[model samples]
Target: MQTPDQIWNDADLPTRRLAGLALNPSAPQDVLLRLLADGPLAVRMVLCRDRILPDAVVDAVIEHPDTYTRSFFARNPHVDPAQRARLIDDPEWFVRAHLAEGPRMPSPARPKPLPDEAIVHMISTYEDENMGSLGFYQQISTGLRRSLHTHPVAKVRCWGVGRWSGLSADARAALLADPDADVRERAQRHERYEDPACMERELPARPCHGRTDILLNRALSRAVVDGVLTAPAREDERATIAANPSLPTDVVVLLAADPDPEVRRRIASRADLGPDERRGLAVDPDPKVRLAVSVHPELSEKERAAIDYEVPMDCGFTFRHAPEVPPAPEAVRRDALSAHPLLRRKAAGDHSLPPDLVARLAADEDLGVRVLLAQNHPHAPAPLLLRSFLEYTGRERAHLTTRPNFPTTGLAAFADHEDPEVRALVALDPETGPATVERLTRDPDPAVRAALARHPNLPPPRLAELLDDEELAHVAAANPAWDADTIRRLAAAPLDGRT
Candidate 1:
């Protein structure tokens, strides 16, 4: 039972290889360093796979010549900004693509310019592939505008307009009327024409779409107050506002008070709206408008309480922030309890609600309301929570089991609960013993067996027992630890025979 560090320092290759398997954070730093340096390339590859490795170690292996080694660094969450920049230009396309697509890659300090040589090469070789790769069709088009106009290749110029319009109005207008049909078609498709007459010149001061739009428009009127309309014309102003989300606070305040309910609703939905705008919407005449404000993530509990009187039965907005709302005062809680069933259900979901209130709601006579409380209520005792779900029959049982955090404790008792969902949950529980998994391997439902087979805690012996079950065998084969011997044995076993 040598420790990982002891094994790492051992002179033998086998010991060094075994040390690579111990990747926990507590493994000695020198052990990791040794693995990074002198260990076999395969062992170094495994060490690089660990995301929690020290920064020094990660940096050292990031440039490792092995493609998989470099990829491991590219995908490592802890790879620093400097390493990301290096990987972005990696010779391997897969590594570069991985860096480009990974969310953890730090945004480049300066936009990487499409190099003249590369741009030329791309124009010569890949110009006809797709508009997407030329970097012009996507929103916030940049980097390709200049090259498209003056490239040595006309096809590249034509492809460029098909992808991006020049920033200069005159250049754009000329390109719009270019002889090439592809160029003209793309300009027309994205409405990038430079001529004012080609597009809608005037828009409403406050354009309202459907009912939802009207509420958003109203919220904007109240939130925006100054330079509320700053465009060349009022219509242009409205269009500009719609296009850009950076409207000034004064403008947002003015827009929040607009007569249109949709305008108000849109403003309420904006995460950028300030406290003043939110407070105003909370008291809006329209219940839907008030409901929008009530559920806003930034609205304080006091603001939420102030709008409680206007909660709408038809909308789920009030319940959206149930996880964040502070505990309502006793009087308010009682009022909420006495409200319509839907309102009671909404209140029960409030994570801040007193446990007693949730406990009381768990006992409500209406099964739907009780189920809602059980699923939404964050603090209900485990046993009571399980009992509440057990009471559901038919479709109700199916609905209850779909909740993401359905209780796992009483699952075995309900293994035979007529509903497949209940049995599926039981089989899926990681805590289910090998014996339970063995029993479930023969479950009448294929989904139940699949769930049991995939459980992380399924014993190797139990997994061996299912070698002959086709679906179960497939699941067992997919496990990372499934070795060549296991696969060969499973393949040779008779279809319905257990080992």
Candidate 2:
């Protein structure tokens, strides 16, 4: 047999075709390049996954006649940034859409900023497809601002107004009155401009009323300065600034002394904080601040334990039992469980805990703790818990009934449960037996009776029996299987009788 490299370089069309069948990682790079463009789409697709495909060849395939071939390159993380940039404007919307929606394109070791023309084209084409293209939006916004007075496209100018509505009052007022009606309309409706003074207020000096407009304006300004906004910001803007991961190191460092507890909390949570900063915050005056820092995800278990040791009991317990970190061990877990019922409730819902830990807490004496465990436990045995609660009355049974997957077995067993809520749960269970439905039809709750009357599996005779129960009869009449005759009968049924 020919060596893999020799087979790839055979040059004879039949030999090259045969050689392409060999899936060797060491296949000649030149041969892979030729095959990437000229080979069948499948062969080219496979070649796209090869780490050996040079940047130039990848660039060439990006504009290949076949969209699937271009998509393969677009999805490849190794594809050079320059090539990826060019493909962002591929005439085929599918290819452009794929590029826009694909995983973050890895930037080069020494990446050059995308050109203004390319950035503008990407923003105009792909903004609707993926709003997270923040770099592209920033570039376009910057360019539009520089050329706003004479920008050719009103739509582009309008995009600038919508994008930069978070700017200062003078700047926002100018955009709101721009020549384009759409720009004016967007600015007028803009949530950012609703509060005139919120964005201009200096934080740590004074706090504003927590109005929607004030929050939105402050949040938007903070987001623009920080380069990106996390999906959720904290209640306090000072805390938001201190906790923001994307802020410059200098800016974060300067925020360390911010007087607000929330701001100090954010500083404690900073991933970039050096050992000294961590230590300093570990002993900070504020208990909340110390707790927030101790539970920072960046801190190792050892670091957290150390911080827990140095802190006071209330603060240490808060940090030790914080939802951010996993329960330290069985001993620590027991301590957290014993500290406060609320702490036990928090521990029960900590997603990072082992499933067995959560399962153990699922039967906690506190209904809230059990409810939290049931809700957050990934492996919660719903059937068993529901079954166990079959004999529970009042609020306890009501709580179980609200879970996402209602315990059908337990609920089915409670078909004759005296409480309307339990009987109601059984009536609504998709797995409810015909006998269970019959029992629920007599439930005192009109809602439960109505649910049973409309059940598709309900026997025709049983449904007819409900025709006398006004609310249930009305629900039964709406079922598609109920004929016009059935509806007519239900309409004439007496309102006072039970179904």
Candidate 3:
């Protein structure tokens, strides 16, 4: 809070002087002018970051001999359109790269749209593998998107082709006749794409031709003989009918004794089979039938836990296709108050658990158990959720803050907490008042600023102030407060302005 003169007169570390400069957002133009002219690169960078900068000071920074000094303005949204035009063509590729992404930066008013020519320039040079003027594409009008359908660059035309839903029938027809093979291929492919109704109609009628296809059809009306399918003239057809749960219970029991091992395998997968039948199938000579019984949805929890296939993770394979075993509701409710915290944690998600049990889990000593209660227990009391915020440290507090009914009436206490991470979570809470949000906007931490940058509750003026920060560009673009037209206007560069 020292006077600007004091900052200049008593400089110890340049960073200290810069810190002092940052404290005074409304520092006079003359002071900024001197800093831009005389300050070291770090001090000057900090000067550029201030929300307000005089025209002369901006010009001085732009005219500086060092590429980094000049380049810094390219990423800054406050740079006027005329200044941006000049910076966009700065000799440094780094400068243009920053400007290409500059549209994402916050602006009090929607930024003047980049001309179509500038967009083409950005497409040609500034794009990398990760981002390629994607926000620009999101903002442009449908007509502009269509115009790119025939753009000389294949990549641009390909991007245009991908917006299939937006194209007019006539335009699509023209694309089908396009000289480029890729354009024609995409257009032709889109032309042949069927609507849901058409796809349903085109599906082959019943009495399917292939043995495998016939067996899989759930709708085939075929007769069963003594619990064995007799309609299929073929052996595999009987196996498939045996697998169908629609078959009568007596028919399935008959199929269990069929000569074909495949018939028993099919029966092993049926949902209607009783426990005794499954136990018999579990010991079938065919390993596939035994494996199916082991993983069957009806298998008891203890039974499933005992049937260990190769523990896939221990075998060094990171990805494994395994059946999920959800604990039964009755079992989960029983375990909700168990001495084992892990079992209690697993049971916290059971919707059928008594309300009192849910409250107990919410107050569980383990942080993870409490988090599960917050996420899965809909009836968890407000006091328990608030206690989580007040008692827990780190991100656990943040987790409780996002829960559906977590109390926000008195959450102002955490608004100015020392931890930026905690403050960032508070910023995301929909119930946090605008006054608290506006105060957090001035928070020194960039992480907190980033979180506030797109918070729906943040007042527009405060939201717009964040536009000047390059680090917050993406979040600013995504703020829900912006109406569709406003987003379109702010995100896209227009074609009329040639520069």
Task: Return the top candidate by lDDT.
Answer: 3
TM-score of 3: 0.36
User: Per-residue lDDT for 269-348 in model 2, tens only?
Assistant: 77787766777788778877777677654665666666543322221111111232346677347534453454465676
Ordered by lDDT, highest first, the candidates read: 3, 2, 1
Better structure of 1 and 2 per TM-score: 1
Error of 1 at 205 (Å): 11
Q: Please, what are the lDDT tens digits per residue for candidate 1 over residues 1-499?
A: 3332443354233322222232433344555565566555445544664346676676677656666556656545443434544565567766654443332322111223333444444445442432243221221124554457545465666656643432466666766686777666665644523322321222233433432232222223323323334422233334335323544566667778877676677777777888888888888997767867666668555556767444332322111223112565763385346534445665665655676776687777555556556555555556555665566543334444444556776466666768665677776455676677767767899888777766656678776555444445545443433444543343333323333
Instruction: Pull out the clashing pairs in model 2.
Output: none
Candidate 2 residue runs with Cα over 4 Å from true position: 1-259, 280-291, 306-410, 416-422, 428-447, 456-462, 465-470, 479-499
Write model 3 residue lDDT over 1-499, tens digit each, in one string: 3333453445334233333343234345565565566655555554564345677777777777766566556545554545655665677776666566554442112344455666555565655541365544543434556588768876567667866666778777778888888778877655544232332333343445643443454333333232225344454667767765456677777777677888887887788877878877776777766656665657755765554322111111011111124557677675675554445655765645677788778777766566556645556678776665655554334545555677756555678778676677676577888888778777899878767766778888776655444455435544666554443333232222210
* Clash counts for the predictions, in order: 44, 0, 4
Off by over 4 Å in 1: 1-216, 219-332, 391-410, 428-436, 455-462, 465-470, 477-499
Residue-pair clash count for candidate 3 = 4
Each model's C-alpha lDDT?
0.52, 0.54, 0.58
Worst 10 residues of 1 by lDDT: 316-325
Write out the backbone clash pairs for model 3. Answer: 106-467, 113-493, 114-493, 227-251
